[model samples]
Target: MEMSSIVLRMSPTLITNVRIFDGLSVVSDCGYILIEFGNIQQISKFPLPTAPGWNIVDGSNSTLIPGLIDAHVHVYQDLKFIETAIQYGVTTVLDMHNESEWFKKMKLVADEKNDVADIQSAGLAATVKNGWPSAILRMTAAADATLETRISGWPDITDNETADQYVATNKAAGASFIKLMQEDGCALSLPFPTRPIPTPPLEVQKAVVDAAHRNNMLAVAHALTNDSVLQMLHAGVDGITHSSVEPINESVISAFKDTNAFIIPTFAVHASSSGEDRHTRQRLAADLADTREKENFLGCLHIMQAGYSIQNSYEQITILKEAGVDILCGTDSSEHLVGTRAGASVLHELWLYVNRCGFTPIEALASATSKIAERFKMKDRGIIEAGRKADLVLVKGNPTESIDSLNDIIGVWRNGERVVWE
Candidate 1:
């Protein structure tokens, strides 16, 4: 058995006096939790019956909830981002895109109890030749002769054959799901600074989604406009990674309601890129201590000042929510990405769901936890209950009353082990 498993089998960790949010609903009667063997053994109104040698934690005036999960993140090979995530109460991150070459190395330490958030990646997203991310790559890649080579390195899926090959390669690389890029780099009616790039044709996108389904994997599309979203929906994608900024009319809402697909929205991403949500920006600036983080935050603001704005993104999000479409939380946070800090941005996304999209704190919390777990088909870690993974966050004050209380994170535990944030 793993060392962490052995440790858990020997000593149970018991926490008392915490207000519990078990991912589905708040537990009004519970104040104690017993965790052992990396799972929640029991939750009770009073101290649970326990054997000798169990560890005890006092959680006076605090709220205990499932550890936050970011449904959309682009993970790098470096482990620092995962460490930062754990420190800020994000115990799980679903990487929307990453290089396949990094998968083996990433998987090695993914579940290690070394204060790192566990990661599940869509190893290298499916892209067309000279596509949406190519321009992004050109801008970010080194200005050497190798820049063209780097851009050329991206997968080029032009037809069903290539799409099949791409899926096979990613699956061999241990991709948890397939990510299809449907972005044209324009914000609805807005234009890109460079010539707009193309997304995969509808047929190719459909083929990839079909292949992913055949292999028992989900196909998640990264789309940001009405047309792109509709195309993906027709192609039968399981999820839309970004909320479209295109005007959300009754027809569009109806289409979403008709489908079982969910949306991650990444609203904080649009807000950060557009320099909107001054409150969120100011709050994030106030919390960041690292110079790198501050510089990145400022850099994203500068980019947003230059980028096209996504009009009425909040309204669209609210429309989707009201239409009973599943809305998941994601920050699109990355080290190179400006406007978002790795671990901190997830909380910003939650805040946007509550303050901007009119989500109740409970509903907003569910977006990041249980809803995401269910949508992604990730088995039991999103909620706090018996027989579930003991990934949890403890914060002072009740976040259900004021979402800002999430910032006051007092402790984080992943798989029943306390993360040493200090």
Candidate 2:
């Protein structure tokens, strides 16, 4: 198992013995991918040496996918998270939070994916002052109980830490795109507001979108609520994150569907087992009873079914599989879900979509690869076939039939470099 210690020069790398799901169809034992430089040179029947000095590796009974792309993850968190992502065969992780200097650093470390998958980012969320990032947007000490008082007393504000300026600066600093969050009535309860929260003022959202669009960039928004999503659509934002769990009015959902805008349900973050937040401090932590998880699950299911497309939330996105609503894979919590299994979360998400939401596995995988390629205009790598990028994963079994097989990952290769698992 000794690979050359000398950093092999990037030439062509051959990955063989895979059960390849080549984007369009799956091939058994005929999985071979070849990569040269940063492109996926070709995918064929057992790629072999046409020239000398090329690197080579044989996969050990692993599931080969297109090196899963977790479209929304916190890339700045820790290198260990990247290590875990690689182990699970994720070749790319998109960071949605934005900042200029941070973007430069993230790019430097992630540019070619030296230690992990290729990393790209959307700068900090463009949100109303005191919105979206209640805690992370700026330093704050307001308790949840005191949240209402703080919102009322606080002026409509944006912070230097996460202002529109920070978002714009990241683009210059090399952000892949810009991300925005819409604050509507639903997010506020009690005196905060009665209905779903309204979106960030249109003019403010426009400023961010216009700036990004003018630069030929894409803008994704945190719009799960009906009104919030409609506002983004009206602003001409390109994409959405989150699927509404509650209902929204019908007319708004129709507008979104007609526009054909993309919605990325960052379901993984929302599905996080209540285990993620130890910070609740024993005082605030809601202890779980035996039936609590089930009750919560049922509650979420009810929300999933709410509104036009579940009240414009499309909460149970799978129900719309027949509607041809293009969905994409994005685990907004990848950094926090760190482990050999975090990469497996996307696969788990696919399962949730199927067992819970009713999408076919093929549809789910498409959400991760092909659909993303189409949405981002990154057509080269999402699929497998001749003349496609060889960024790949070699799994132990066939993913075409059972996505669970993807969880049995044995190796990953990006631009043909056999990503030796750490």
lDDT of 1 at 38: 79
Deviating ranges (above 4 Å) for candidate 1:
1-10, 141-150, 188-194, 301-311
lDDT for model 2, on a 0 to 1 scale? 0.59
Which model scores highest in TM-score? 1
Q: What tens digits encode model 2's per-residue C-alpha lDDT throughout 1-422? A: 11232224667776676666665556655656666765566666655556677666675454466767777777654665566666666777777763445546656655445447677777555545545554332222224675454344322324333345655566666778878777553432223422343345677677777777877888888765566677888888887776654554456556657868777776555543212212211211123232433232222211121122322223446544456666778766544332113454566556566556666667777778778877887766788765665677777766666766665666677666667742
Ten residues in sequence with the least summed lDDT for candidate 1: 300-309
Error at 44, model 1, angstroms? 1.6
Residue 207's lDDT in candidate 2 = 73
Worst 10 residues of 2 by lDDT: 276-285
Clash totals for all candidate models? 0, 30
Show pairs that collide, candidate 1.
none
